[model samples]
Target: MRIDGRARALIAADDRGLLYGDGLFETLRVRAGVCPLWDRHVARLRVGCRRLRLPPPAAGALERDRDALIAGAADAVLRITWTRGSGMRGYAPPLAATPRCVLALAPAPAIPVHWYARGIRVRFCDVRLARQPRLAGIKHLNRLEQVLARAEWRDAAIAEGLMLDTGGHVIGATAANVFAVIDDMLVTPRLDQAGVAGVGRAVLLDAFPKTRVRALRRTDLERASEVLLVSAVRGALPVRRLDARRLPVGPWAR
Candidate 1:
């Protein structure tokens, strides 16, 4: 692990990221010593930095760190966490805050090999996401909502849980974005109010530019013929069942 462009393991205890979640992160899948979606990830990170009012990393700082860590490496998951460095005991940020970027590379998660071919089951989470348009669509450090939603179930048969915002709008899954095929039309939820706009969802939208982006409800998901849960780690997985509703793995998911 490297922090602030150096090979280090620890950060200050008073760091704003640790105290108040004042940071953003990007999780990229690395293959053959390269990130497949580096450009998209950087683009999203730039947007996140702009929204969070934090200084972007130094020129080529991330690239240099990534190169040093993934040298001659095989498949892995590289997470880059950028945080507002240590500050006094308060919510207001320091004027000359020095941001810290920590890069950690780990073995790629072992996904069920058959999940792609055979869909996975999911349930609706009881925890409702707080609607915060200012923080929507960015990969921020605060993830308690997702954490609580994930803890809702522990059944091995259930792969994930769909999360809804306070207004009953389908935000996304605990970790991924949701896509539905309603009336033979591809549709996804709008992230203006809540949820992260994942890169996998962006890939699908680029592939199918006609896919509608709108406010979706549980009823819309129920009416859909097929649904897909997409994420950066797991590209796209078909949803075999939503709670008790049986869904088919159609050509879209295949």
Candidate 2:
């Protein structure tokens, strides 16, 4: 792990990130010592910093850290966390809070190859996401909602859990973005209300023409011809069964 461009493993106890969840993070998929989506990750991190009123990390500095951490590994998972450094005892942030950055590298998990070929089963989570437009679409540090949603299911057969917002609109899965084919049109739920806009989802939106970003309800997913759960680490995984609705592993997902 590297903290502020230095090798370190500890962070200040009074850090605003620990106290108030005032931070942002990015998880990138590394392949052969290269991050194919580094640009998109950095772009999203900058946007998140702006939304959270935190200074964004310098691109050059970030690149150096990433390179150092990867260290010519064949493949890895990189996680970058930016926090609003330690502050005095109060909710108000320091006038010039120097942001703290921690970059870590880990070996990629050995996901079952079959998961990519055959669709994965998912279930609807009982925990509903709270609507927070200001924090929506940003991969912020406050993920207790996701933790709770994930804990709702313990069956290993279920690969993921689909979450709905308080308004009963489908936001996506616990750790990925949702895409579905509706009447021959590619549709994904808009993240202006809640959920993270992952790098993989961005790639898909840019690659596919006429992909619609709109409010999606449970019924919309139920009626879709195909459904895919996309993430930076896992790419795209087809949703075979979502709450008893058995979907097909469409060709597009493959």
Output the number of the TM-score-best candidate. Answer: 1
Candidate 2 segments whose C-alpha is farther than 4 A from its true place: none
How well is each residue in 1-254 modelled by candidate 2, as lDDT tens digits?
99999999998899988999999999988999999999999999999999999988975999999899997878889999999999999889999989999999999978888888888999989999999999999999999999999999779999999999999999999999999999988899999999999999999999986899999999999999999999999989998888888988987787
Q: Output candidate 1 Cα RMSD.
A: 0.8
Candidate 1: tens digits of C-alpha lDDT, residues 93-135? 9998889899999999889988999899999999999999999
How many clashing residue pairs are found in candidate 1? 0
lDDT of each: 0.94, 0.93
Ten residues in sequence with the least summed lDDT for candidate 1: 52-61
